[model samples]
Target: MPFIRSAGLRGLRATITSLDGDADHYARLGGLDPAALDADDILMPDLAAATTLELAAADLDCPDLGLRVAGHQDLSLLGPLALAIQNAPTVAEALECTSRYLFLHAPAMRLTLEPDPDGVDGVAALRYDVTAPGVAPPPQGTDLCLGSLHRAIRSLIGEDYEPLGVDLPHPPLAPPATYEAFFGAPVRFDRPSALLRFPSRLNDVALTGSDERVRQLALQHLADLSPAEAALVAPTVRSAVDQLLGTGAPEIGAVARMLSLHPRTLQRRLADEGTSFALILDEVRSSVARRYLETTDLPLSQVAGLIGLSEQSALTRASRRWWGQTPLAVRRVAQSQRTVA
Candidate 1:
């Protein structure tokens, strides 16, 4: 059995809430027992595995009802929770309370802030590292988790909080339109880690107006969590390609530097892993091309440039080589499927 990592529990909670009604729709389509997902007792790992299986079986269109349920529940709970912390005095005290109390409703996720280089900017971010024992090749759950977190935080802060950027450990794909809709910013995937970058202005917002009593309670709650649970940090590789693609075309040395390794060492490591840097780059570009062709109304030429192809002809050849079909042909097939659905 694949163990769902603890780091992902908060995200799991958020996803479950967001997809509550969609579960029944999917259960019917996928021949699943809807009763298994009743509110009184939600199946976490079972639901995650079942959802992943159904998504693969259904061409990734299955509504992730479980995730929606988690999201909805999380949103409902975070408000009161945030208010509880906000009642406390001092930004530091409120944060301390929040960090300690947040886990009562969702699994503890790490929050940290560091001074930006100029000392004028403060970078605040949250992270959760899930570990599922014996789970080989975990799917990109962080994407969904962060998707829910973005919604939850925005709800707390109001709609005007513009984030600097978001980083994920997987390549970009279709689905979770929330990232683009909510953040109104570029989302970078396949980076060194998962992060949400925001200006330090957010730090000034007091967590709660409450006195020190609430602060003390929050801190004690945090201290009560098992030390064993605190050690959960899942391994993830931030995609160098995602970073490079955000800028212009990237050189090999530059990509290597971002990964904090020498170019030669990076090449040798990739080769040992039975892949080459060139092959992975092509794979990333191809994946992006497919997503653009399927989801967006962008012209083929623009899509080509977006993925670093200099000309439409080059993109055409690459798409043909990767998918054994022309870009237009692929788009037609995707459109046809959408129409059928």
Candidate 2:
């Protein structure tokens, strides 16, 4: 029954050339005036409805047409923007450029790079983070944004670039079919946070000569971005997770209290979205484990504690269930990958 927001409607308008059929479909499903639906509001439907719309639009065969109509219109904007970043002067500048300009097109999202001391030696990697407004979350918009960003960057540089892994805040259910094909890496769910990781060498690439002036100009343009432009979507739940994660052993009841909802209500809502608390917990633990394995000298036992696992044995058991491998085995694979790269 929730309607899409006006901002979302406006954003969708930028991508969609016409809303004729889309409007009729929405009117039939939502029993409202499709013309009255704002671009942002168009994506306010439940996940299943949204996914069906996305798939149907894509199958319609228009150029970037499907992406345009998707409720999270940010995916359509990231492509050209990432291409611009790839043309920047150096890897450092390219990353900086991406971090800076990404908001101009997508808003509410930031990409950062940090140096890894242990994993991949001295390689620096980029992280994509989304910040949106209100208690309502962005749904799967985060994944779409990350996927589009990855595809754009790969196209600009070269397809051999390793795809970034994501740390989702919910359990996996019926994810989009193109997810594995596009991400080309593991996608962990119900994690404490979302993340994207790749080797830092891509940062060394020289920026296209013509882009330097544009980068400077874009910086000035971004300086004017409003706080609402970087709105934090689903702040209530995100804040609850933030506080709970600090405790090392957060309970669902505790989290529910923090969000001012009964545990039963929380569970129902999460189920409506096809996720659960246990799945989110495993996702967070798995992601933290991977990051520790790839980026630090932390022992397996220590890594387990960081992600709320009480003992190494428990961590191993959970990892095997989620990934069909032991934590050490996963680390070994990552190590081998680093060696090959």
Candidate 3:
């Protein structure tokens, strides 16, 4: 039973209209007495208030409603994690640090960073895993998480910075056109994960106002505050696979070596965690394939190479099997709305 800090709760409260209409309902739902919330620091359990509003909004067919809520928040809502990111030397370092310290802000979920699954040239993704326990994840909650993360990165990298695209696990509630306009990027629903893709090189861009001392302090604080060591393996393995994808399709032995564990031991451990190396590899490939097809102009042959195929036809075949459409068709559908603009 983890609690999402007041910052997330307040984001939900901001979505309410007419004080007499939803304010009291929100507070009551949250188990709050209406006057105690500070908007910046009120902690709410997922079941008490957050999920109710999230589901209600989705039921009303307003999927992007969470994006509107995220409009009122920024990196400052992340508190010390924000300081850590702002002080890091490069955007990549900032992202790594943020993922390392996810429990501090959003303990219910974690972030997964990966190179383009096909190890597509210059592409990478930072994905959100919102399947934390205690409460079922809802559309509104997913929206806020994605929207705020987008805003948070833009705040760090500059306003004009945008990921090549965003992916969602659920289908769009509004018409595809309306939702696409709000996200300002190509968005695909019913995908494997919620991901934001960008050029991997962006990781090297130095932060404008970084300070090593501040970064060190933030890291130290996160270390002091992180949960038991047992909670870290899955994301660690995924990250290692991400970096290795660009070299070739990732291998369990290579990933195990990177993690400093014997291959057999690593296999056992991942199995105990309810997954396997091959399954993780498939997931990684799928995530990357979808991303590259929709966002980048890489030739199909190159795309196939990056993902371990010997030919473009192999990629076309795989795409059809995985998505029920050819890679070219996926790309065209993603571009259709923009063609009209």
lDDT of all the models against the reference? 0.52, 0.53, 0.71
| Candidate 1 per-residue lDDT over residues 117-182, each given as its tens digit | 122446665443222211212233554556556665565566556777776544454454644554
Runs in model 1 lying further than 4 Å from the true structure: 1-71, 75-147, 154-238
Q: Across residues 1-341, which tens digit of lDDT does each residue of candidate 3 receive?
A: 67666676455555665222365565675465554245656666655545555544644445566776778778888788888989999888898888878777666677877765434788898888665521235666777778888888888888547677778766675577765676678888765467787778778888898899988898888778777753657767866775576577788888988888999999888888888888777666666676566656678787777666678898888888878999899879856743652
lDDT score, candidate 1, position 241: 69
Q: 2 or 3, which is superior by lDDT?
A: 3
For residues 46-153, could you state the per-residue lDDT of candidate 2 as single tens digits? 333344334434444432332343334332344444444645676567666676555554444556564432256645545555543222223344444454556556
Sort the candidates on lDDT, descending order: 3, 2, 1
lDDT computed for candidate 2: 0.53
Better of 1 and 3 by lDDT: 3
Report, for all candidates in order, the number of backbone clashes: 35, 19, 2
Which portions of model 2 show Cα errors greater than 4 Å? 1-24, 27-86, 105-107, 115-125, 132-137, 175-178, 224-341
Off by over 4 Å in 3: 18-20, 30-37, 55-62, 117-120, 133-136, 230-235, 238-252, 264-341
Question: lDDT score of model 1?
Answer: 0.52
Best by lDDT: 3
